[model samples]
Target: DQIILLKDGRIAETGHFEDLMAAGQTFCQLISEYAVTHRGQDGSGSSSGADSDNAETQSQDMVGSGTGGDTAAAGTTPTSRDTRAKDAKKDAKKDKKAGIIQAENILDGGLSASIFLRYLRAITYKYATLIMLFQVLMQVCYVGTSLWLKYWIGQNEDTSPESRPSLSLFLSVFSGLTLVYVLMGIVLFWVAFGVARIRASEYLHRIFMSRIMRLPPAFFDTTPLGRIINRVSSDFASIDDRIPWKLFEAIGHAVSLVASLTVVAFTTPLFLVASPFIALIYYYVQKHYQRASQAVKRICRATQSPIFQHFQETLAGVSTIRAMNLQGRFIATSAERSDLYSNSFIALAYGIRWMEILVQMVNVVITLLASLWFVLLPQGSVNAATAGLALSFAMSNSQSLIWFARTYSDLYVHMIAVERVQEYAELRTEAPLSTAPDSETGRALEHHWPQEGRI
Candidate 1:
């Protein structure tokens, strides 16, 4: 019906296709070029005139289909432009569905034994054994020093001076044990835990990096650079610093708790009757608190990744955002992410406070029971030294118990970083960097056979 052609941003020709063809100008030349380029597709070996007619009919059909208009009046098809628009829409939908930054994955249930084993393997069995041994030695010296104090008090109270140990000897032995205990603690923290943490961090980081480097490009397309950065920066920092300290403190507190309980039981035999019930209460409290604590910690950590992702994106697109005048929108979005993280952190703090109150109540109950037992006991049934030691340990148990639960929960929560690191470390990497040669010829090729410019 009508034909229009533009050249250099101005209309060059306008008429019916037949009239334009008859004119034998720009429109006709364009039709002839198209037909010649697609000659193989037509497969008829027709003259350019016939092919041009076929092309005109195809254009009419395409334009009519696209616009839902009369075929004769629709004009040119614009096939390439239409195809590109359709493709762009499809890509947009796909990208919206499969987001560039994936949500952080969280594992449910309690920390697995496998994760512990993985960490132990990373640190090596030798270092782990040494760490355990040093911890035990440190605890022994601590408990022994306390017991020696009880013994010294007993000797001072004795009416028979001949049986009493020399004061100089007692002081020297006590001082020597104190020195040994301090030395053991120093070594345990700086040497055993330090070296083990460093080694584990290095091993996990290396494998994680190796796997990431070998991963296919498609992985990066879907995974945000910020998510990767979060793993390497925040997660590894926790592993390097927070985790080691949490683990060491957890173990130390646990050992100290056991020692306190043992001393309490020894000095106060009747208290043993209620120890089981007290332990059961502590177990349930820790169990429920730990579950909520870990969940909140996961939420806290997950929200952190989004913040980091957003921050990185904002930094990268700062100029673009400024140009678009979208700084306020980005800042609002960042504030929202930070608020989410802050809310999770607040929940975690509430959980800790709840645990503290409950644990303190339990400790008070324990101390009250111990005091009642001592006051009610028959005269001379319990000696002053043993009773004083029991009271001191019972009082100290409050702090020890709370620290034990806190450190234990923290240790497991921090282990999440290890789990994540190990997940990447064990990921299915891309095919080997250098595969076996294809055949004899490939095997025989020289290492530097591909000389410069040979291809």
Candidate 2:
């Protein structure tokens, strides 16, 4: 068994692919034998000991031995060992039938933390700094717009209208800046998608498949088909998904958020007070929403498995159902299951809606408070001219802050997808048992490369 520790210094998982394979093979034989021997206790063979220790042990050991990590862990992983094992087998069989390496499997066997980080660094290093520059400029424009917007709105309020022109000017600049951001966003997506499809995922997939194909025979024998399939499918997806979204979104959002805040602080020091308070509220709300969402997601996933199982069962036994005229029953049952799934989602959405309502309430409260302060205040009552400018700036900045806060929750929600993809990308693969023969390697190289430039 190979036991690896997670970043948290806890044992991650333990298993040898070889052991899983042997267990699987043994399980199949045992199942067949049990089926043949099964009968009533009426002077005939029967499955008397089917659930006995000996038989039970064989079945349990088949799935449990390689899944020792899951058994030992304090909390259960999302997927069960048996489910994982089954999926792996299905994937392997699919691959064999297709006569091509599984893309999912290959994806799972990608780089580890150290290697993956290094790759990420190399990929982002060149563009990251440039992106930051653009981000700073965008932030400046945002602040400029915020100040002008406040002035514009304030000018329309009681007292003389002095800040109107400044507000209009700021609005024009802000709109232009926003258009630029949109254009940049489009360009970035184009480049990232092209690179990932052509170079990143494809290249990694190739290397991963090559390594997987060369893994020691024992590795295959001990590992569950589902776990392996998960690594290939889920893990690969993690990496692929991360490259375009998590990585990019994190970078883009962080820059924008910081820049927008910087403008707010510079324009109105008093406004800075709202930032931390709003952030804290957002954090508190996010923690609650995240927990609820996670629970909802787990339920959703659980419901999906049984639904899928029933789907397959129905398809496989369609003839029997038709003959028995039980198609309506199956349809009704499916509809019920689907309703359950929908309800689970609705519950989740309701939770999100409540959170959103709370967020909006906070924003409204903040806006009202700021407006009240600007309206009253006897002496320094923000001199009609500056008051308009100050209010416009404050509103814009506050709105921007609210926007940033909202994005954090949205980001948290989206991170589930990122983690799923990462899980697959971090899967481990065993090394090849045999190295290339030096003589054969040389001959193959000579035949292919033709180093002398011969035809």
Candidate 3:
């Protein structure tokens, strides 16, 4: 803790706090005196000569302070005394420039990709297969229910000439199967929800915390606190809610769907033939959904910045707003941001709207075409039971495809959430090391220390 307040009036070196104080680190004390003397000239830079005079006075004050530490412990002379003075002068110049050079000056872009992958891999590895499984199961239930419903309705319409409409076997089976389908869906949803909560919290929270903590202070300087808080907290929370619900739908519906389609394919291959066009239509819709989702995600992130800025400004200047009577200006600015947000949302959803319409229209076409085939075919041109069953299958498949389309649409949104999480996780970082003279000096001695360099 020994110190030398050098002749040029900057810190020389120190070993410990008490030793430095005894050695007189009175730079602060002298600066305080200079400030007191120049109190009236604070705002006005005054004369350059006055500034020079202050520096000389401060150095003179340190003359006695250096002598105390110059007498070293035992019989040693300070080894790099000349180099130390030169370096101290250079250090002061760097400090003077430091304020003007922002944290961004030293930034390296290399950290971004590494950070993004760390978060992305964590979430995907945990949820990808589980989510896919859930979707498959959900589709199965959805398709099964629709086909069974169609079969029951068609059977009722084609009642035998000799019988009254009572206790038909088709009606009985449909009713029982539909009930089971609905009940199973409810249970699957609960299961999906439980699973999602368990996994969602694990990855989401850790990634969010790690990203925020690792980000440099410069990031916070430009980025609003509210926006960062919202991204890490509210946005991720929304993603959590949206993802699990979508996943549950995809699973429960997917299972019933495959089962229902299997029952129909058993009766006729024609039903499967009709489904591909519907699948094609669905594929188109899903592509559009992905495009829209990515667009929305970009817009949402852009919107957050300005909104956060305005929000912070309003919060910080509430008194100013009131005193200046500029509430109307603030209101107008807020409205402008709101309008921007609205337009961005509308633009993002435009593709989705068209896609949904096309999907629904294609579905209707599918159903109408199936009905035409059923009605126009001669009574025995195809087996009556088989044709009837195939028509039932076609109708169910169309409905199931619509559900699948919806699930895919939801999947696109969830992927946007995933992308956002990835973006946050991939933020750039730096590991600034202290450039203290002691630490720098030790590096050269590290390998040889206490061995060849001993006594």
Number of clashes recorded per candidate: 0, 32, 27
> Cα lDDT of model 1 overall?
0.79
Worst 10 residues of 3 by lDDT: 101-110
Whose lDDT is higher: candidate 1's or candidate 2's?
1
List residue ranges in candidate 1 displaced over 4 A: 1-101, 161-163, 437-455
What lDDT is obtained when candidate 3 is compared to the true structure? 0.58
**Candidate 1 residue lDDT tens string, 1-455:** 67779999999999876566555567755554353345424344555455445655554453344332233222334453233334555665788898665666877888889999988888899888888888888889988988899889888887588887789999998999999999988888776566898998888888888899998888888788888898899889998888878877888898888888888888777668988888899999999999999898888878888898899889999999999999999999999999999999999999999998999988887788788889999998877888888999999999999999999998888898888887777777786745456753334455786787765
lDDT of each candidate versus the true structure = 0.79, 0.53, 0.58
- Model 2, 1-455: lDDT tens digits are 56332446655434564443343443233342342222111123323333232334444453455553222221222233333334545665677787532322212222245554534454455555555465555556555565555555565675466633555566677688677766766656665555532455665566667766766666665544544554455445645664445555555556665654454455455556776887788678767876676567445544544466568779889999999999999999999988998899898878767777776766565556556666666676455655555455445544444444445444444334334444434556564334455654332333345557665
* Ranking of candidates on lDDT, top first: 1, 3, 2
Ranking by TM-score: 1, 3, 2
* TM-scores of the models, in the order given: 0.77, 0.52, 0.59
The number of clashing residue pairs in model 1 is 0
Give the alpha carbon lDDT tens digit for every residue of 1-455 in model 3: 34456656655654654354334445433332343234323423644444434433443353435543232221121233223334555665688877542321112112245433443354455455555654565555555555665555656657775663455666676677667656755665555566545566577767767777878888777666666665665567656777666655665456556765676656554557777876677677777676666566556655755676688889999999999999999999988987898788777667656666776787576557656666776776665555666666656665666676667566555545555566667788655333344664343334444675545
**Once model 2 is optimally superposed onto the true structure by TM-score, how far is the C-alpha of residue 63 displaced, in angstroms?**
37
Q: For model 1, what is the error of residue 367's alpha carbon versus the real structure, in angstroms, after optimal superposition?
A: 1.4
